[model samples]
Target: MPPLLTGSLYDAYGSYALVPAPLPVVAATALVLTATGVRRAVSHRAPAVAPH
Candidate 1:
C-alpha cells in the first residue's frame, strides 16, 4: 500500500497516473551526490593564501 493511494493524507498525486515508488529516494540520493562533488571541486580550486 503506497502512501499516495488513498492514505491518511491527501496528496497532489491523486490526479497523476502510475507514480514511481522508488523515484523519490533515487532522486534525492542523486542530488546529494552531485552537490557533494561540486563542493569538493570548488574547494580544491581555491588559491592558497598562506605559505606551505
Candidate 2:
C-alpha cells in the first residue's frame, strides 16, 4: 500500500532539487539534435553500386 499521487510515481520534480536545472534541458536538446544530424548525414552520403 502506497500514497497515490499525480504524474510520475518516482517523483521527477524532486530531481530538480538535486540538479542545476538548465543543465539537464541543454544536455537533452543537444543529444537529440546530434542524433538527428548524424542520421541525416549518413543517409545522404550513401553510394550507389552498379553491376560490373
In terms of lDDT, which candidate is strongest?
Answer: 1
Cα lDDT for residue 36, candidate 1: 100
lDDT of 2 by residue, 27-52 (tens): 89989999999999999986988899
Off by over 4 Å in 1: 1-19, 46-52
Off by over 4 Å in 2: 1-19, 48-52
lDDT of 1 by residue, 1-52 (tens): 3664534233555543445555788799989999999999999997969978
Each prediction's number of clashing residue pairs: 0, 0
- Worst 10-residue lDDT window for candidate 2 reads 1-10
